[model samples]
Structure formats: C-alpha cells, structure tokens
Target chain A: MQKTLKSLSNKDPQNIILIGNPNTGKTTLFNSLTGLNQKVGNFPGVTVDKKTGNFNYKETKINVVDLPGTYSLSPNSEDERIAKSYLEETNQNDIIVVVADATNLKRNLLLFTQIVDLGKQVILVLNMMDLLQKNTQEIDFKKLSKKLNCPIIPINARLDKGVEKLKEAVFSYQQKENIFLDSDSSSSSIDETMKRVGKINTIVDDCLTKDGEDKSYLFTKKIDNIVTHKIYGYLIFLGILFFIFQAIFSWASYPMDLIDSGFGFLCDFVSNILPKGILNDLIVNGILAGLGGIVIFVPQIAILFAFITILEDTGYMSRVSFLMDRILRQFGLNGKSIIPIISSTACAIPAIMGARTISNYKERLITIMVAPLISCSARIPVYTILIALIVSEEETYGIFNLQGLLVMGLYLLGFVAAILSAWVMKLIIKSKQKSTFTLEMPIYRTPRWKNVGFEILSKVKIFLFDAGKIIIAISIVLWVLSSYAPGNKFEDISKKYTSETSQQQYSEQEISTLIASERLEHSYAGIIGKIIEPTIKPLGFDWKIGISLVTSFAAREVFVGTMATLYSVGDADNTMSIREKMMAAKNHETGEKLYTTATTLSLLIFYVFAMQCMATLAVVYRETNSIKWPIIQVVYMGALAYFSSLLVYSIFS
Target chain B: MGKSLNMTLDRLKENESGIIKQINDEDLAIQLLSMGFVIGEKIKVERIAPLKDPILITSGSSYISIRNADAKNIEIIV
Candidate 1:
C-alpha cells in the first residue's frame, strides 16, 4: 500500500479536496478533473465510497480526494461523517473546492457558507452553468465572489467547459492572500437551522437574478405527477423492473453463450495442442472450466450494473425509493433497499456493496442478510435442468410455456422469501443504529451516459477484484481436491482395467472409461462424498450427488460441471448428456428411480435457499466488517434449505 | 384550515401545503432539518405512497420521502 501510494503521487502531492452537495454535478466535475486517473477505496474504517486521484497542474502534482456528496456539514449518515471529519482535520496547505449548482443556488450555498465560516481558504465551483440559460437564471459572479470572499468559477462539468480556467483558478488561488469570513464556526448548530436557511436565502436573493420562478422544475413536476402517482407510479415502476429483468436474462444470454463456447473451445484446443499429462489435464479440465464459470456471468453483471447506473444518472433511482418506502418499511428495509434487492438477482456481491448508499445501518444489514435468497443467474443453470427433469418441454398453455412459468415461479419464490426473511431478521437484529429514511428526489433528465458508463465499468472492475479473487482461489483449491487421490488405489484400478483390456471383449475406449470411473470412486473427493452420503440420504441424494453438493460451495454453478464430470467417467459419450446419464443410473439395492420428482424438487429448493457461493460470504464479511453476519447468514439459510427440502421431498414422495 | 390547521406531516392531506413548525422527534431532527425541514420552510405534499404511510414532500427544489413514524413528529401548518 505504501509503495503504490508513493509511486502514484509525486513526492507528497498537494491535497486538493473536492466537496459538494448532492445533485450539484460534483461527480461530473470530479471526472472532468481526474478523468480515468483515480483510485477507488474505502475510508479507513467506514465503508462509504472514497475516490482519490492524482493530476498534474502546471508542472505541480495535485492529489484530489472526492468526498461523498452531502447536503450540509452537520453529519447524519456515515457518508456525511466522512466528509465532515475530513474537512475538520484538514491540513493547512490543503485547498478545499466546494462544487455548487448554479441553478439551485439557495440550497447549494448552505454547505458553502458553513465551510466559509470555518475560515478555510476555499474555492467555489459553480457547476451546471449550461442550465442557466435554459432556466433564465444568472449569477452575478463579481458580486457573489465579494460577498463570499472566495474565488468562484462557473463551468458546465458535463461538457468540460471552463475546465482549464477552473484549473488555473485552483493553481493560482494559493498565490493570492487568504481571505476569511468574520463569523467564527462555533455559532453553527442544529438550533440555527432557521437562521442558516434564512441567511442562505438572503444571499441567494441578493446575488442571483432570474426572470422566471421554478421554471426548471416545472417539467420535472409534470413528469413527477404521473411517475409519482399513487396507482400509475407503481405500475410504471413494476413495468420498468420487469423490462430490466427481461433484458438482463435474455440479452445477457448471447454473450454468456459466446463466453461458454469460447472457453470450451479453448480447453479442447489446448488439450489437443499440448502433450497429454496431469498438468495438461488440470489446466484443460479443472482450472479453465472453473474460470469459465465466473467469466460467463460477466454479461449479466455488466447489464445489471449498467441499468443501475443509468437509473441513478437519470435521477429515476431516488423516485424508486420514494415509491417503495412504505411497503419496504414494514419489512424494516428502507426504500433504497429496492436497488440492492433487484441487483441481487444478477449477483449478490455487487448488491451487498450497493447497500452502502443506505444511511441506516440496520436496514442495510438486513438487506445484505436476505439478499442471497434471491435466485441469481447462477441458480438459473441449476433450476433449468431440475425443472426440465420434472416438467416436459412441449407443455404450453396457449402463449405461455409451462416450464417457463415454473422458472418464473422460482424467481418469485426467491423474492417473496427474501422479503419474508428480512421481516423475520428485522425482529431479531439488535443494534443501536439510528433509523432515518430521507431520500433526495432529483429531477428527471436524460442520463449522463458517459458518467453511467464509467460507473458501470468501475462496478464491474470492483466485482472482479473483490469477489472474483475469492472465486478463482476457491476454484483452484476445488480443482486440486477433485483431481488427486490420497493413495496408489488409483494406480491399482488402472492396472486392473489394463490387464482386463487384453483378455476381455471391451474396446480400448470402454476400458479407459471403466478405469476412469473406478479411479474416481476411490479418490479423496469420493471418500468425502461417501462420508456425507448418510446425512443427505434423507433428502434422496446418493454419494455422487453428495460430491456435487460439496464441490459447489466454490460457486453454485459448479454443480453442473461436477455432475458432468462424475457422470462422464463411467459413460463419457458425445451423444448422451449428463442428464441422460443421471436418468440411466439406478441404485444397487433397490432398482428404484433416481432423479425422481421428489429428489429433483428437493435439490431445486436446496439451491434456492443455500448460501453455496463462497464469493458472497467473503463480500458479506467485507461489507459488514465482521464475520458474524455472514456466518449467521450461512447457518439460517442452510437450516431453511434443509428443513424445507425435507418437507417438500416428503410430501412429493 | 379545519383539517390542516394543526396537522403533523403524517396527517397532512395529499397535495396540501404547509410550513414546517418543528420536528419533535430527536432521532429524526438532524436529518430532516439538514434536508430543509427547517421552521417556516414551505413544504407541499406532492404525493403519498400506496397504503398512505410514506408521503413525498417537496421542500424548495428537493423532493423527500418520510415515513409515518418520522412524519408524525414534524409539526406543520396549513
């Protein structure tokens, strides 16, 4: 950490702070100033978003810390506290930049004035200058600069206009003598809310002039009337949600198919190109397949986050929270919890991190706890096969396919279970965390596509680095466990099969498969599978199914590959599939059916509720800053999956 | 004025206008006040969510959602 920080900065780059009120185009300005040259991380202990970047200004290096956008200095949420504390403990040479919205000067200046009263050398950046002409509002820059006793620069951050001038002001501001306001910071308090509002209003009235009143928000109000309507609002919201879900599932499938085939082709190509050995087999069969498991889901993750950022950029996200507030509150979740819950459908790692926006800790915790209950894209693989076994492909009711309806039912069941679990956990989690659910509904506008794109790119990168790291590591460990055996029992099986090859009527291919299956049955993984066979027998699973269950802890989707491998050793054929193989298998003692309706349904229920993915547990630990929540999450979900499967299998049998 | 005269935020009718007199709840005081629920600020109930508990209020140029528990403490005027 120390080495990277030193290498990035040019020997202690000057600390230039970027602060602002929410919706002031601060993020756009930060992007304009730093571009893609930024390092994203968490502030020391708190998990609020912290972005720092290094840029060169006139041969001098400037290090800028982008504090989370806040309303005022008096802190409420953890995000607010980070910005407030940073300003309070500011270094002497640090230049504080306050980004303000030019059109909405009255409210934006509230924070600017508080910082000015702190007697710091501050620069006021009047952003969104492009909207001034549209709103017919004008700021008297000369008069406003004199009143505030600070350097003020007006620029439209989106278009990157006046950026060089702003940079010049930032660099040259240090050359000028420091100016301080007369009042000390002591008088600012919650008791003076009225006083502060009145003062800022007066300042706004004096230095700002406009021909029309509230004209900018008039269009916004018109849209809000319909979008925020009692009945139509919810209908539109659900409609949009359904649209997004369809896009995430259907559109992502194209890229997912390409990725899957690409990996399969690569593995086969490498196996043919390289000399056959254990290393070649490990790379071709184990490592490449494990990596393909995660790389395929990238398309779904990219689409889900792209939609999330687009909603945020267009200002529709806060309105969602506004609509969901009442219903979710009954489950002890905030309106903001909707984003995470929807995001969980794609993957839980990003969903848990997205909960950082929720100011209330308890609500965020509950959201994280119940998030994995939502059926993710990984579960779709498991659900599709199981549902296929239980239901027929040709069964359709006019327009809707019966099998597709069952898939939809599984999704709805996951969501209903998430909310219900949240309701139950709400009554249990005891925290002194204060509850506040106030959301600022920004006016609707065409999304800032550039900003949205950048945000999506960053979220995907974070998902890869945080969850992807754990996934790859666990997959490697699983590869080792499944590939090797403890003793020469594998050699004995190969020897026995080879000796019989010369004396028997079996072909070389048939002999090799027998040897493969025999060796796998005596491997360490097989012994472990046998150990858990009795425990899972009540759920109608055998030792082979137990192996898939154990290996899938690395990722839920690995269950498919595990099943394919286990089935292939005995009957590896291009014509017959893993499902067909499972269908052909029968118990030695009773010639009874396996993969029956009861067992398949039980397995589906198990995948729906079990916390099978290690990546999610790692993220939950990182987000909660404790292992206790993730541990409790695993236990309760495991217990739920177990008992529910037991009940469902019994009734079905 | 009969219904709106001494109503708290939770009791305010949909599309009603009021000036925030006080936010009596301690837990909600800082957040609401900072988000511009200050005394004498004119707030209009733009809409109420379904089930009539969480209501949207527009203060200045900002629209915010407040639950019944927090809204019950926000004393308002017609």
Candidate 2:
C-alpha cells in the first residue's frame, strides 16, 4: 500500500492542457506531442469533443488535453464554454501550455495572459516561428519571458521543432502569481479586456522588432482579389462545388464497389464454412449485411472529409463562409452552415456533427434539423434500382442519360425541400440569442497532410463504431422479425412444398424458391406490412412495398436487400434480375402491373423525402442532446414524405 | 463623440484605413478587443464580400470578417 501510494504521488503533474486562439497551430503542436496516441470523447453532459492523448518523456507518461480555440476566457459559444469550464476545474498538478502564433502574437497573447492570470501553472509556446523569421521579425523571448514571469519557448510546430523544449518546459513549469488586468478596477468585462489589451500591446512592442513590412498578407490579398470578386467569386464557388460532387459520385464509386464485393466474398465464405442454421443465416445475412451497408459509405465520406479538411487547413473555408453568410443568414442559418449543408450530400451523420461550428444556438439547431432532408450517398443504390425500373440506361435526352437526369432532378428536389424546411423552421423555432458572424480568416497556406490524415481516421472511426453499433443491432432485430412467424407457419410452408406431387410439378430449385416467397408472406414482417398496407395504398404501394418500406427504415439502402428477399431473388447485386421480377409483379385485386411509372416515381419520391435513416436520427438525438428534436424531425420529415409521395402518385396516375 | 466626427466601419470603402474610436455594443466591444481590435489602433478594410454584406477587416496581425450590421456598431475615424 505504501509503495503504490508513493508511485501514485510521483505521477502527479502528468497533465498538460493546451489552449490557444483560433488558427494558432495549437492542434499541430498537440499532434506533434501525442502522435496518434489520442482519442476523442465528449465533455461531460455535452457533445463537444474532448481530445486527450498521452506521450512518454524520460520513461514517464504525460497526458495532454487539447481544448477548443477561443478568443478569450469569456464564453461566446458552446466550444468556448467547455474550454473555459475545463480550465477552471484544473488542479495545481496540471500545467497549462498556451500555444500562440508567433506571427500574430498580439492577438494570441490575449489568451495566454488570460490563462496566466487564472493563477494556474502555465508555459507559453510561441508556434509558427518560421513564418515570423521569413518576415525578418525578431522577438526578444528572454526579455518577454522575464516581463511576463513565464517561461516562453519558440518552435515551429508544423516541422516538430522545439517540441522537446516544450516538453521539457512542461516538466519544469513553476506556478507564478501574475495578473494582467485588475478585475476590481474595471466596470464591466469589456473594460477589463480593453485594459488587458492595452498592457499586452506595450509588452509586445517592447520585445518585438520588425525589419520590413510583413509580406504574408500581400499574397493572400492578391489571391482574394479574384477568389472573392463579386461575379468571379460566386462562379468559382459553384465550380468547386460541382467538382466536389463529381468527385464524390464518380471517384468514390470505385472504392465503394471494392468494399461491396469484398463484403460479398466475406459473406459467402462465412456461409460456406458454417453449417446451414439460424446462426449461419444471422451471421451472413443479418449482421454481415448490415455491417456492409454501413461500411460501403466509407469511401464517399472519406473523400468528402478529405476535401473539407484541405479547404479548412488552407483557410479557404472561412472565405467561403464569409461569402455565404449573408445569403444563408436570410434563411436562419449562419455562414458556417454551408459546410454541413454540402456535407449532407455524402452523409448526414458527419454533416450534423459539422454544425458545431455555427456558434449560434438557433442557427445550429436549424441546420441540424434540416440537414437530413438533403439526399446522401446511401440513397444512391435505391435511386439507381428504382430509376432503372421506369427509364432504361440507353434512353437519353440529347447528351444526358434519362436515368442520370432523373437522379439529378431527385437531388435538386431534395435541396429545395431542405431549404424550404429550414425557412419554415426559422419562423417557428424562436430564440433570444443574437446572431453574429465574426469569423477569422487565416492567411492561406498548404494543408498539413498529416493533420488531414488524422482527421479522416478519427471521423471514419466515429462513424463506423458509434453509428455502426446501432445499425447492426437494429438489423439483427429486423432479421428476427422477418425470419420467424407466430406459429409453425414456416414449417407448414416447407412441409407443403416438399410433397411428392409438388416436387414432380415443379423443379427442386423452383419448389424451394416458391416456398421461400410463401414463407415470407406468412412471417411476422408480412403481417406488419399487411397492417400498414391500407395507409400506404394511396401512395400506390402494395403490401410487398410496405414490407420493403418497414425493413428499410433501419437504412435506406436496405430496400434493395429486403426486395430481394420478398421476390426470392438469389443475388441481391443483380439489379437486372430484381427489376425483371418487380416488373412481373401484379396488383392482387386489379391484376395490373405493380411497378408502373406512377408507382415507381412515387416510390422514388418517398425515398427522397422520407426519414428512413436510423443512423441519422440516432446522430440527431446525440447532437441535439434532446429526444424532442429527433422526434420532431421524424414526424415532420415523415409527413413531408407521405404527402409528397401522395401528390406524385396522384399526378402521375 | 459627435456624430459628425465619427463614422461607422460599414461605410468605409475597401482598402480604406481608420482608427477605432469606439464599439457601440459592450459585448461586441469585448469580442473585438479580445480578437485584437483595440481602441486607438489602425484598422483597414481588406475586402467586402461579393454580396456586399459581410466585409473582411484587418487590425495589426488579426484579420476577421463581420456582417454589415455588426460593422455598423464599430465607430472609427478616417
């Protein structure tokens, strides 16, 4: 007991909390210190990411927590609130490392001085030293360090320089009694901040010397001349958006195909190795199929995230936000909502998470609520199969494929619906918080590729694990609901199909297939479908379509898998076979073809508008931190889908 | 503090420079100050967005964009 207690005490001062202003390269320093040893979690009672990592120095493990960047100790946003609260809770054993951009020391030091005045043990790290050197500027760090009563270290975080010195400083950090502003002398928070700024300006001027004017912003301003030009800016923004869409749809398809086939091969292997039983079916059909559906979207998501990270790292996203803020704010969304709105095309889960940057409560909530209305990549499979039902691949209107044109129209329809919903919500959901867009526009630079890689890895991990767990569990439940019946109905179907006369009338393969389809009709899922058939009948959907709708509620792409089972189609990948089977299906009462143009188009419209993605709802619940929002989302979106599909069915029929 | 002596930042043309006299809103003042926009400091209008609502401005080494409504709260001397 004594030895353990001694060891525990020796491990004291193991934590180093990193804080800084926006665009200060603080994250780069954290990456250099932790180097993939990091994990992102949520702060207690909130969804803000709490990134904590550990690194070893001299055989001792030092843990680091990278806090969100904020302009001051006063909180203006959720991120800043969490950062400030976390800082206030730190004990004496924890040392605060304030990373400041050397090129912009005047603004960066405001955060550092605030932390130092908090009476916490702190070390000042001056990052971006290389940029300062390029401008022929010099900082008398020793004098600055003495005046501030803090140990200051200069290093280029991007190149991993001076990281060792930073770690060394963390080990030897001593608490200093310092205060930049006397709080009691100020009449308000604003007055205190102004006084602090006045003091910092003097200190910065005394220690820093410049040989010439900084040329960094000169180049940035030159590029901005064209990039932010009135006509050219809007055109360039659209061009880049079009390019991103093309990349997502075309480039991502190759990897998506690979993942699809790979999962198929794995399913086959598992089925062959295991004995034909409930367990084998569950593994191959239920669990593996569900896993594949989620993983198949990885390529599209990664590509989208890569592009977004590059844009942000190069400081272009802020420019885009500046250009878009005025227009978006008219619809109750902040400028930062542009990222999440566009991101919804690839997936809504990450898109919803991306709304964290909006800062304003009402705007962020509206962005989250309406984001799922935009079509995502998971809708691609359903659209392809359904569009092919009415329009052939060979059919074209001039140069555009008819099927492709219809898909684009569906995408456009989704965008219009989303914008309209946001506008309506803006009028309904009331808030007292004022909306402001005071965004920093960092100077452009080449993206840190390593940081981009880390971002992709972390986001993909969250999607695959956090959302994947719920998807797999729901799929298993759906499988059991569809595979089993109330009585010995499944056995009865099998037994009748095994009769000698039946065998003679139909081939062995035909008999089995017939039994499979008949058995599904008697299953619990079929009963549920029949129960809801009357409600969906106005949408030109039959009981079979109802079954597909119910099953696909767990995931939009599962409509294909469920349809394959309903028709007893052996291969789910063979879209042509499914199309043929669906074409032959008939209305039980009228004896008319089931997949008419009206019904197919209605179904396509439903997929476009419906809240069919369970993962998105789950993410919405987590992000909003309230059951009310997700419930509201489901009801509103479902009503929209039903009414829209009803309208399309009427117009076409 | 006369109206004739002060001009709001929103009226400044692109590439124009001014000295900040006051920020009308207290919260906005704290925000701008912490972001390195102190009083008596020279601020330059970098660019007005394409739509002419939110404009980018630079003070010292800090550059940021604020909407026209927020910019109107900032009093400056040309």
- Winning candidate number (DockQ): 2
Interface RMSD of each: 2.2, 0.9
Model 1 TM-score, all chains together: 0.88
Write model 2 residue lDDT over A282-318, tens digit each, in one string. Answer: 7776787667767877887787678878888998878
Q: What is the lDDT of residue A67 in candidate 1?
A: 92
Looking at candidate 2 chain A, the ten consecutive residues that score lowest on lDDT are A568-577
Model 1, residue A560: displacement in angstroms?
5.2
List, residue by residue over A1-653, the lDDT tens digit for candidate 1.
12354344336557889999888888888888898888787777655568888788989777888998888877766567778988887755567899987877777777887776665668899988777778777778898888777889999888999888888887776523443334445664565655666777777678876544556677877887788787898899878766666576567768877987787678778878878776776665556655665677677778867887788788887887877877897898988898888778767876887787787889999999999999876776677567767787677757656666676777788899999999998898877866767777777778787787788778777656654665565555555665568877877777777685454878888777667666666777678888998998888787778988887787787776666555544542323444566777665336687788999999998899899988789878978889899999999999988888898889998
Native A-B interface contacts kept, per candidate: 0.57, 0.86
Query: For each model, chain A TM-score?
Result: 0.87, 0.89
For each candidate, report its DockQ versus the true two-chain complex: 0.57, 0.84
Per-residue lDDT for A383 in model 1? 74
Per-residue alpha-carbon lDDT of candidate 1 for residues B1-78, written as tens digits (9 for 90 to 100): 786666888877888888888778654776666665667888888777766767778877667787777788888887
Q: Candidate 2, TM-score vs. the true structure?
A: 0.90
Error of 1 at A202 (Å): 2.0
